[model samples]
Target: MYELKTKENDSSVIEFIENVDSPKKREDAYKLLDIFTETTGCQAKMWGPSIIGFGSYHYKYESGHEGDAPLVGFSPRKAKISLYFATGDTKREELLKDFGKHTTGKACVYINKVADIDVDVLKALIHQSVAFLRETYPNQ
Candidate 1:
């Protein structure tokens, strides 16, 4: 009996972006909104308080843990922008080679700004993530 902390909510994605402490970060958040929206063909939704997510899927692990998560998302954080994509996609590492300047964590790609990355590669990452999630968890 576990509950997911980052469930999708009816929060305003724009309001969240508008409140980003840094004006530059706020601007980049808008740019990312457009990129993720057009690339994923999905409207942006607020996941939790800060994450601007596009599209979603429900996944259940073999250990019986299950939750719904966005196919792709990003957050304009105080330190750096966090990009969320499918975790197990084999192409993830390959795509990161052309993703421009960024660092990777288990589930997020961290970038200093949109200018630091190739927009084309970002779009490809978004598409790949959505497709991977759809294939990995079709029923949800």
Candidate 2:
């Protein structure tokens, strides 16, 4: 019996974005909302306390750790904007090659602002992540 801390909930995405501390990050949050919405054709949902996520998929690992997670998402944090995409997708690296300035972590792409990255590449990443998840988790 394990609990997933980042489960999706009935939180207000707009309110969350509006509360982003930095004015610039707040503005970029809105832009990202639009881009992710348009690209994934999925409405935004609040994941956990902070992440603004799109479509979701359920994943069951070999160890039986299972949970549903958003296909793609982003959070405008105090330090940097965190972009969430499917981690194991090989296509992600290819697309990131053309993506503008950003730093990658184990599960996030960090950007200072929306203008710091290529919106088109961001869209492609979103698209690929969703497709990969759907194919990997077909019945979800």
Candidate 3:
């Protein structure tokens, strides 16, 4: 079993974001970080080397896989901002239908720019995702 690091290294998070060369990208990242942390009630942390993660949960699968991960998080990548959460093909499908200007992977949603999406809708999605995760992984 691997031990999970609990508290965030705020300096790392700030330094990493600050080092982003693009002013626009850096601005966008900080903005998203504020929103994500505010919305999730989770302290923002620098995950690994680049991800800005929020609220964490511990999970142990029947197959023996176990770890701690942010209940919800995002990565402000070069071209887009990636939101992480679990998904069902149709779950939150309606929300996605209404979520503005973005792309989706299996469980990650990508927003090209904050100006392109509805912030309220994004919050709703985060709430829904967190709720779903809580229900799905009750023990966590």
Q: In model 2, which regions exceed 4 Å deviation?
A: none
For candidate 2, the per-residue lDDT at 18 reads: 87
RMSD of each: 0.7, 0.7, 2.9
Local accuracy of candidate 1 as per-residue lDDT tens digits, 1-140: 77788989999999999899999999999999999998988899999988999988988899989889999999999999999999888998899999999999888999999998999999889888888999989896
Write down the TM-score of every candidate. Answer: 0.98, 0.97, 0.85
Which window of 10 residues has the lowest lDDT sum in candidate 2?
Answer: 113-122
Shift in Å, residue 41, candidate 2: 1.2
> What are the lDDT scores of the predictions, listed in order?
0.92, 0.92, 0.79
- Across residues 53-88, which tens digit of lDDT does each residue of candidate 3 receive? 887777677998777777777877887888887676
After superposition, candidate 1 runs with Cα above 4 Å error: none
